[model samples]
Target: MNESIKTPSVTDEASTPQMKTKCEHHAECMKVIQAILDDQATEAEKDHFRENIDKCIPCIESYNLEKCIKTSLADKIAKKPCPKNILNTIISKINS
Candidate 1:
């Protein structure tokens, strides 16, 4: 069987994602990015973010930065015994 490989046309907008020239919703996108990075965003929100992230430079940068920071902190945290007073309070609350 013979087949022809189709090349994407330069003028095809669907083939190429238009890079955002200006980050107009930078502030709102940052909040969404933070929620996404922190595992707090809903699936719909995440889907929206995934769809648009590559098109927005600022949001992608924020997502990378926040992810890096969270990973670093998780690595650096040294687990220790909980404070006696706080532990007691938590236990009491749980028992109540």
Candidate 2:
């Protein structure tokens, strides 16, 4: 037996009701979100994101959730140090 998974096309994904209701600027919003996460967004992109967040409830909620998750993860990592022994072991394994 053979099985395959089906992936939705960009057009199909963009046409969903949820996507439509979320924001007409969905593509731009996503680009801004990704750029912000990657720390590569320009001032214009940041401004665009800020503007959309004010006008789009869904965009604001999504942005807030992502920002919360990212901040939580960074805070947790910053507070936790890897043990020296574990770090050395991993380094040695990689060197081998």
Candidate 3:
């Protein structure tokens, strides 16, 4: 009697890279990401984000987190009513 064994495929041994943000410019990265999403970023900021996104995983993660926060806040703002008194208060604070 003869027994045969099948070889495992390369995919069986292959590992996936961890999805993580490794960027050093955590604050700047998040700001850039937010600015991009909001369409408030300048050309220079866009360049910065593009350059660092590939190199820094931490910053990328931070960027994603900031985006999530911004989206959530936008949804919240959409749902809530801005009281006129509160609006006045904010305007007053800004003017002060």
Instruction: Tell me, by TM-score, which candidate is best.
Output: 1
Task: Please provide, for model 3 over 17-41, each residue's C-alpha lDDT reduced to its tens digit, 9 standing for 90 to 100.
Answer: 3444455556777777878989999
Q: Rate the local accuracy (lDDT) of all candidates.
A: 0.83, 0.78, 0.76
User: Candidate 3: where is the Cα deviation over 4 Å?
Assistant: 1-22, 79-96
| For every candidate, C-alpha RMSD to the true structure in Å | 6.5, 15.0, 7.0
Per-residue accuracy of model 1 over 6-63 as CA lDDT, tens digit each:
6667778577877875788888778888888778998888888988888987777778
Cα-lDDT of candidate 1: 0.83
lDDT of 1 at 66: 85
Clashes of 3: 8
Identify the superior model by TM-score, candidate 2 or candidate 3: 2
Cα deviation at 15, candidate 3, in Å, is 18
User: Which window of ten consecutive residues has the lowest lDDT sum in model 3?
Assistant: 15-24
- lDDT tens string, model 2, 59-82? 777778878888888888756688
lDDT of 1 at 53: 86
TM-scores for all candidates? 0.67, 0.54, 0.51
